[model samples]
Target: MEVIAIQKSTLEGMKNELKELLELTENATQKYAPIFKEEKWLDNQEVCLMMNITKRTLQTYKDKGLLPYSRLNRKNYYKLSDVQALLKAGQPYKSNEDGVIDQ
Candidate 1:
């Protein structure tokens, strides 16, 4: 094997550059942390519990195009925003005075 050597100054410069890049990446992540937090995804059970419905009912919603979802690996996921929008719209179901969904 042949041996290759890098100058001490060059090695130091590379280290400094790598450190700066790490710092920049960290700052960017922190700055946009809240935005990522807002876009939460919920699974089938969670959505059903939140909406006070059953799996079949949730499937009906998907069938009727009232709710949107994403399917991955034979499992489904729903966006918190879309669910909130559906609740606000009160199309297929309505909530009574006690906040119970009325079908």
Candidate 2:
């Protein structure tokens, strides 16, 4: 009976661990807080993440005329509309919403 109790406790602990892991994953997957997908355009950081590039790379794209962007008070920005257009140009993307590349 003691052995059975120990096994049961171990199983419960593992279950709790699994639950925590799942919660962590869920939170990570929801890392992005979409506050402007419906009402406003996207910013530089959002476009950078969407294209899997950095802010400097974004500036390069802007300079190359490959991507449209703007600057306000020294802060650069990219519009969601522009991102959609770039996608049409075959810029390549992982996924539209999730930003996950296909493996």
Candidate 3:
């Protein structure tokens, strides 16, 4: 049996490098995670892309009052928080007049 001896200083240096790498990995994961907790406004195009729905469906949702939105001029904006909340509700759309899901 042969033992390849590693020096103490080299071991200490490796340990420090490992620690720094771990910290960097953690920071990167936090910065680029799949889910974002912060609330922000989304435009119609952004909302469509995120929800995987068509633009017409988005308008239908707005008209049916399923998704809450804000209008300025001809453009509409929705809150990311509200959309996430509705998704989390997991309820069927109960529409007397095409009812939107409960949020």
lDDT (CA) per prediction: 0.85, 0.68, 0.74
Q: Which stretches of model 2 miss by more than 4 angstroms?
A: 1-39, 92-103
lDDT of 3 by residue, 2-101 (tens): 9889999999999999999999999988985644345577899998777656666677677788899987698988888877876677423432334433
Candidate 2, residues 1-103, lDDT tens digits: the string is 3544458789999999999999999886676345344445677878877877656656667777888766768876667777877867766423334544432
Residue-level lDDT of model 1, residues 1-103, one tens digit each, is: 9998999999999999999999999999999888658899899999988887767778778988999998869999899999999978875864455656557
Which portions of model 3 miss their true places by more than 4 Å? Answer: 1-39, 91-103
List the lowest-lDDT window of 10 residues for candidate 2.
94-103
Count of backbone clashes for each model?
0, 0, 1
Better of 1 and 2 by lDDT: 1
| Model 1: residue 76 alpha-carbon error in angstroms | 0.4
In candidate 1, stretches whose alpha carbon ends up further than 4 angstroms from where it belongs are 1-38, 91-103
Best by TM-score: 1
